[model samples]
Target chain A: MANEVESTPNSYPMNGGIGCHSYVKNSHIQRALLHAAKDVITEAIVEKVDITNPWFNSSRTLRVADFGCSVGPNTFVVVQNIIEALELLYRSKRHNPEIPEFHVFFNDHVHNDFNTLFRSLPFSHRYFAAGVPGSFHDRLFPKSTLHIIHSSYALHWLSQVPTQLADRNSPAWNKGRIHGLGASSKEVREAFSAQFSKDLQAFLNARALELVGGGLMLLLVSGLPNEFHSSQTNSAIVLDLLGSCLIDMAKMGIISEDNVDSFNLSIYRTCPGELEAFIEKNGHFKIEKMEELINPVRWDPPDFQMLASHLRATFEGALEEHFGNEIMDELFERFTNKIGENSHIIYDQQYIKETEIFVSLKHRVTDYEV
Target chain B: MANEVESTPNSYPMNGGIGCHSYVKNSHIQRALLHAAKDVITEAIVEKVDITNPWFNSSRTLRVADFGCSVGPNTFVVVQNIIEALELLYRSKRHNPEIPEFHVFFNDHVHNDFNTLFRSLPFSHRYFAAGVPGSFHDRLFPKSTLHIIHSSYALHWLSQVPTQLADRNSPAWNKGRIHGLGASSKEVREAFSAQFSKDLQAFLNARALELVGGGLMLLLVSGLPNEFHSSQTNSAIVLDLLGSCLIDMAKMGIISEDNVDSFNLSIYRTCPGELEAFIEKNGHFKIEKMEELINPVRWDPPDFQMLASHLRATFEGALEEHFGNEIMDELFERFTNKIGENSHIIYDQQYIKETEIFVSLKHRVTDYEV
Candidate 1:
């Protein structure tokens, strides 16, 4: 993939299904993220929703989608939490009327292992579940039909690695890097920023077509914390280590150096300003709240093994695709040893492990007309 | 020159949306019918259903249908009751830890007022709803897919009125009379009976292909009492009064006398023996319980004006089609006056009111192997 960046799956899903090391394992992180958006989510269910609104209430069915619902035990867990939260809000109403019935759609890329997602579903008489495999960047449902949409830890992923990054003549070309990281060229940063802006606009445009008036959308995505810029957080360190490992491998002649030079991770670290600017430009939704959530660190960092395994689950597929599958075990082993030897790493800085940007947008009434 | 037969609503729906005299207003009759089948439906819930079976239980989504869901306030009511009953069964056992999510399909003819159904739907956070409009006599759903099916006051309707009733050469041709009634020719009776048998078989066969093993079906239909055959019940009085009204009009040169000869209601009254023989012949479901419900007389019949209005609302379309719309008011006025003049008619013989056949069937296990 030195030039052609069309190959996707290697960089597609974080992991498959509900496994010990799969996406479910990191649910505590998502649960915390959901908790951060509880106020807005509750507000969306109670204050923002009109109980007697004919478009949604008259149908007696509530349609919801978790747009980037990767295979999960977490998917079910997060939705369950949301339902409970919404139920609590409904119970507190003065009139205390009947609640709308729920139809939940769990959506991800077409290649996402939906069978595993279905197999692990928790039984309930409260709501119905279906797996809708599609990209959130495109329209995946009937127009003006959804009442609520939830997406957590997903939007930061761009549609693909920026092709502009590979153009030698382009000012935004990214060279000698796998992602926009420490001391990355302005060109690298611009390429990633441009891709994110385009993708976010497309996402907003599609969702605008799908949500009913007074509908709400809650999103939890990775972002730069306050006072941070490109490559400043601990997330950047992971990229630093990843790129270093590949470079180290290239020097050893185990893989071609040109492959490492042309590859760039298709992801972006969004700040509040960037999020606001994108929302303003799209104009489909009215932003209710957009804030950063950087938790107070409580526990000590996990050992090298735990850290290594987490990264492995996420980046192993991408690495194996670019390099041969045989280099995976050895590559991670080197990564682990390198992290273990860096004594200054743990004490010098906060890695920004849990900083996620949370945004809640109410579907604008004018857009609902369509 | 023929026996009396009252007209069917100009053809019948009580009212479009859920309202007084709507399907919901007839709740008392349905309630009694549901209670009669409670034992078998319970047996279906506990013994017949395999809880841990993956085909249904493992996926965590349960699919159900109400085959002739005309329109709602009652559609929601019945499905709600079923969910409640199913939940009650789930709560009775220590191992009843899991209850699958429910996806309910509301089905009817393509011409059914689904818009009104959706508009009047009640709110609930319980289960999801979707409208599937199609004839139940055909395959309305995917084969071996549904778990439980409920149809009330629908199957007694033949696919269409027996063609033989209009075929002049057929022995069963119902000329000069609209339906099988006392003193009606044996040919008319046989024709209607054969049509009913054929339609019910088609209905059962379609359901057999859709239900999972151990799935249950509950049906409530208008039928004759133990002492009554086709023409002996009070239901015949409706046809009798209708035919009389039509013939009277023809004598007056109000409606073309020949028009009445070609019109027949596409409904049949099913007795226990008939329903039983059909199930036996179809050989897909086991008759867990089949009973005749005969209530003690309690209330006086409605006045002719009220009766005429109710009939008008239901059969007005069919009536308007066969007879000119201009004659509707005059027709019902004549009908009301005729009943007023027949004060001694009630004492002539007992009319079959408040008698319906209730049957519950369990899908046989061998057929579940699809």
Candidate 2:
């Protein structure tokens, strides 16, 4: 049995992130995207699998996988989406169940705590006949066996530390190489792009082996605007808030300047065209559909005040593992203070940022057609 | 080369009847539906036709046909929609110089006035195309030659005469049909349904052959509520108004009560499911997508009043052929008087009628697997 959580690297933080889970749990847009993806997947499966013909039909099973699945509660939402998609495919009369035995892989990072995954196992096992776990980034399954690959909010995370940002000598890694506030230094932009390119390639290579000809891959990742100008008021507002908070923490000497400079944010932004080019270069898949939209994630500050105590208590679950209880409390106090200071901002700035969902179909050179 | 329209049918009283061009001249809903239909047609063409491959490449002479095209300036909108659809499709692609050849067939009943269509044709020989005058209820084109089939505001017209109402021999046709309204008899309902079914079948069969496999069909038709009751205050309002006018005419002995009972409107009413089932039973296609909506006709009493003089002038061309201008002017005076008395009521009632647009792809099975 493979470890499911470790295989899906990008979603490692989701199991423990309180706000992230709830955000994804009730996301109707994400649900619709997944539904559409599932439709494409079922179509691909029915086309490639010969089970539709009675001559090829036998008592067999089929495998479906949702990589980078998180635990807590929303694992079942993914399950619900998948089931609904399957039902639609069946209603379309495009699927044949009798064939090879079904197998499903749920993969994540090695560091991910499986306790949450273990708790949600029953709901998943009941729905999917079989579930296996492993890191998909690393070899987890045999080649050319996957019928469908679905991943959301996972590809943005890099496997190793991002090299462009990690290498201090790199132009992109060095700060202040380009003009002032609002605009990113050209070097920093390049660093982010290089890191994204490397990670996306790794993602494509891994899935290329896993998926058979005519398989489908659906990905929803963070995206940047086509003509993003840093000087825009909306752009500076959130960055200024984050910058102010970091400055406050540095003044208190809670974090060093070195550590601050080492951390790289904004590593996940991609445009639809960029992703399309990447896939096209990889050569074997075709873009079926793409949708890009900005979904703002603003929380109610007035309500936040009411839940201050409960939120403080829950903050322990996040930081207590690395630091002692006292340090965790102090960090929460600072975080809460920052939240109170930024309470004047009308909408909650914290959201999925910019997002894009890409649905692709694996193109194969058939012996007869080619 | 095809004639734009043929002469009017003898059965229809052309006396002051409004032509389609009058309805379409500056309609908002019509434009919106046309734009949407254009988008679907372009996308379907892209998916079905392998434009990149030399063998499958189409000509700059694209053969586009608009069936059930009514005569007058209004047919121009459908032509405009097709032209705009093809143009946008061309621009969206990396400029393919081998543009599709354009040949448009604007088909309608033999009774349609070609003079109006000819007057409406734009003076552009390069792209703007000719009109084909004929009944779509019969064969209109060579097999598999059309790339697009577009129709609007025309499907409701039935092929033959409505089953006659008030069959004096049987009381079955004379029983009370409009339950609450002490007026309508069962004969009217039976007559309407029998006429509608016959017309709908003929309409479907005609379009079925006209649409090539893998070609697209965009249809816009006036629809009534699935559960409309004739006795309802709203439904009866129109009938009551017409009834009063007929009664006045009868008192004057201009038209006989026998003619009133024999008269049946050609308009066909359909619900979503009925339309869907009709397409399904026809077995030539499946619904790619369909939507039912109520679009306001945007007829203000004030606008109608302003256009009344021009309408009367236009009526000269149509009415002079039947009832001489003297009788036509007398009829118009009575209608104008009634409109003035119930201007607000007439405006509010007529525009609120529900309509539907069906965007369906008649899938032709390819050698490729599902």
Candidate 3:
């Protein structure tokens, strides 16, 4: 698998679908909210999901999956939270022990290691459990089987970057590529919007087919509203800082300008109201409850040491692939020095919140005919 | 003159001190702080004072004063915030030029209003200025010659109500004082702390003789340091809402307990750190800068409207008092029914920052040589 993945010299195309740790790192906030969500879901959807009468053969068996299960503290938190809620739900049904039990599944991409997920699981899973691997975009689960689906900090990536993005001759696609710049130029803004809408619908379509009747789907994703505009000065500051670092690396002949130009990373953003409406439009599911968390999505303060370490990590992954490890220390020190002077607030203003977290629940009102 | 002043009927004392409307009613936050102090002094001070300042060398010129000046706002804000360093102090000096010109005395009572003071006046006075009003226990200036020594929100009938407070051992003093409960009782907490010190220093001795330096002591006054000791549960809240109306006539037997106590008034609280320290040390000064103003100090969501209104004029003076009257309806509704239920932040939690504005400069630095 490693050879196959590495054989593709310009594997950047396949990387479009490869979920980055940035998204995974973004899921940490969901952990803090899981406890509060227990009551909210109970009052809003749990009691409404009536599984009374065993003979009626309702969709009594629950399969809860954390779909883009990230590594580290967040994944553990979500898994534990789901189990806690399910246990409470089970205890509530003590009068009728005949109630069907819950089955848990944790799924992620092919690149995600199952060993880590396996080690993190609790020993006591009274209800059944499984670890599914493969992209949700592809066929990863059985048809119409999932009862409750939750994917926090995922689903923003397109199945693949539009081919026309690199094709300069195709005016429409080239325009779409340019529009993804810092959220200024309305045309570029609209370009990202159109692509996001198309990709989001595809995501919804895939989940719609997998969810059983009366299943709940909870999703948390990142986005910036159209109203948000990065001030020219702030953007300039970040660009200058990053530009200097890239220039120094270029002088060292580590990474070529051509590689930087050809690189196309997906930056996804969606409005809360628009996303909610998008889910509602998908006929297979009914919107049971939707709420936008007021706090920022990726807002967390990084300490000075963490800042230095983050620079080192970035270099290790992409930079070290091109440049030998010898220049690693110099490159990291230069980056940190620039950050310390120009972007001191990236560390000092760490306490200021700037991320948004949203939770949405979807229940299967109808089975997929196809 | 002293006996005549003492004999002048108690009509002024019970007449709510000053008319709610006569003072400037449209003051902004800065102005409201000074104005409210004017009222706090009128109602709380026991004697009529010459409110002016006397120059040290040329005894004819007026001396100005401010207690708890804490380096005057401008420079200190920079030291604390680091962002907009010295900008606050620079702006304050530019606006209130009077701070540096007169024989201006800066006082902090002990805990020091240094943040506000330092940020207010940065450089040395172009004309002449000094720091004098120390602790209200010892005299800061001489007798009967003050031209104008301004202290806003400084005097509030002492910390705990005077020691002789409930000693109705003399019926005249005890009458209807909280059902025989002395202000210094365990239930009242620091209520008598100020009065105990004041009586030992001969009841307002500090500022009594310091006026030999000035004439017009413009004072800003009001009940302040809204501390609560379980017994005073929601006293500020009750006064702001229900008590203002009923308590007025309740004392006259116009309303019964069923009608009066049933209504709760909202109370606003301030820290005792400023006034408590000043009273304990007993620094004396001429009462010059005296005027009541309201600067509504509150929290996010503005849970207490009535309290905000009552405190609004404390700093910004009559200007804000008028402004508050206009929005009284919506403000009261929001405070009573909507505050806790909906957390729509109406004001920053640090709203009404300078609760009561007191400005009194010292004519003498310490007790006279006699």
Say which candidate scores most in lDDT. 1
Q: List the global CA lDDT of all models.
A: 0.66, 0.48, 0.42
Q: List, residue by residue over A22-113, the lDDT tens digit for candidate 1.
A: 65564454555566666656665666665455565554456778988877766676687667655665566537566655667777765465
TM-score of chain A of each: 0.89, 0.71, 0.72
DockQ for all candidate structures vs. native? 0.01, 0.00, 0.00
Q: Fraction of native Cα contacts kept in each candidate?
A: 0.00, 0.00, 0.00
Stretches > 4 Å off in candidate 1: A1-11, A18-21, A26-28, A94-96, A168-171, A181-183, A296-299, A350-354, A367-370, B1-370
By the lDDT metric, which is better: model 1 or model 2?
1
User: Which has the better TM-score: candidate 1, or candidate 2?
Assistant: 1
The per-prediction CA RMSD against the true structure, in angstroms, equals 23.9, 25.4, 29.1
CAPRI verdict on model 3? Answer: incorrect
Worst window of 10 by summed lDDT in candidate 2 chain A = A123-132
Q: Candidate 1: give the TM-score of chain A.
A: 0.89
> Worst 10-residue stretch by lDDT in candidate 1 chain A?
A1-10
lDDT of 3 by residue, A58-164 (tens): 43456677776644346556655665665566667667554455555666554344433443344343544344444555444444556667776566544444455
Q: Which ten residues in a row have the lowest lDDT in candidate 1 chain B?
A: B1-10
**What is the Å distance of residue B171 in model 3 from its true position?**
99
TM-score of 1: 0.51
Off by over 4 Å in 3: A1-48, A53-60, A124-127, A168-181, A185-187, A230-244, A294-302, A307-335, A344-354, A364-370, B1-370
